[model samples]
Target: MRVNKWGVGVILAASVLLTGCAGGSDKPADEKPSGAAQEENAAPESDCPELKDGATIDGAALSECVTEAMADSAGFAAKMTTLGMESTSRYNPAEAAVATDTTFGSVVVIGEDAWVKSATGEWQAADTASTDPTVVALSTAAKAVDASDPMGVAGTLSGEYTVTGTGTRLGQDVFLLTGVTEEGGTSVDMVFELTSDYVVLAATGSTELEGQKIESVQEITEWDVEQDIIAPL
Candidate 1:
């Protein structure tokens, strides 16, 4: 896997948009909010490989779904593959320090630095660097549709997501992204965090590969951007 400088730059830049406040001091005991209730019902299970909130999604499984979706989608697969290769090459086992409700946690090796929020409000050095934007776009778009590839312009860039479970990357709480697709498939899953009010924090990837598979898993543990959250401009 080789890194594409141009693509990485674009994604890294876009990542700057993700910025928010992190907890510094501990909340007073009386003021601390209660944690969310544990889901009592079992997520709906199925062969469609949708990621439900609170469950783990296998990387290989995600790749298969992506590949299948991209079968006839022109060069989508190629782009994703390139990103996958790039990501694997640069996926160093490093820790990312970021804010949490209690203490700060790290997201390790979050897919080659797609961008992260640091103490300041700008993109900073992450465990890994980002892949090309084209690749990032294709993969993310595909995942949104619960489809394998970006065959048509029928995908969403943003939507509501619930945290079904959590995973640790360098001991940080990376939320497990899961929810049933309103159309087909079960719920799609990804490891993510809330970068800002609108952005979903994550590393770059070929998350949706050919043959409907997940080719890579990028774990993130920190953000190093350089702008202040109160005034990120």
Candidate 2:
């Protein structure tokens, strides 16, 4: 199948930003803003913010933690469910397909989640592992890692601005990131957020698709991260 180059490009860009530029620099020539560095050099997380000991993550390590957490499909699934992406599991392929069609902008999950297809093509699971990489990666990419000590991710990561905004879902502090990027010859808007502990709480990416900028938002509540106590993402 032909690739939605713009779709993949935007997703990749979001991933790099959320990973705190940890993946290193290497952009395909097809990428835009020629000569623009793909990686942003951020100071070690030790410079970000701080939370109480054993209750928080170091800023530098926070990025790594989020990268790992976002890679966990179960965690992301939980968040997606909160965002109303339920029934798209390995058990119910049909519901998953319908759900994806209603929400996702560029792609959606179909089948028992054993397989996923977007405008680009199909993605078969490499193993029976329940974790969904796409969900985790997208969720993680939306969060903003702290810049100081205990660099937990908490907030959004947008192109023009990133910050810890207000709002709470499932009882976790919500942050916001917003900005714009050009795609398919049009300017698109993006917004995503992280929990206080650095988990992606929710995210929404909107672009002109089907003649309108469709918005999809995911809210992850029911956090069990802190011994069942109320804590930040």
True lDDT of residue 118, candidate 1: 35
Q: Tell me how many residue pairs clash in candidate 1.
A: 50
What tens digits encode model 1's per-residue C-alpha lDDT throughout 1-233?
A: 12221122122212321122123222221221222211121222324244445444544344333223222211111011122222211111122111111111112123222223333233333323246443343223212221222111112112343556644332223455542221122233323432111122232222322345332222222222121112111
Clashes of 2: 23
> All candidates' lDDT scores?
0.26, 0.32
lDDT of 2 by residue, 1-233 (tens): 11122122233333322222221123221222212112222323433343322232333434454434333322222222211232111111113221121122112223222223222334433232327554344323222111121111222221343453556554445456555545546565655565444455455556555564444333332222211111111
* Cand. 1 TM to true fold: 0.25
What is the overall TM-score of model 2 with all chains considered together? 0.37
Stretches off by above 4 angstroms in model 1 are: 1-84, 88-160, 180-189, 194-212, 225-233
The most accurate candidate by lDDT is 2
Which runs in model 2 stand beyond 4 Å of their true positions?
1-65, 69-76, 79-158, 181-186, 221-233
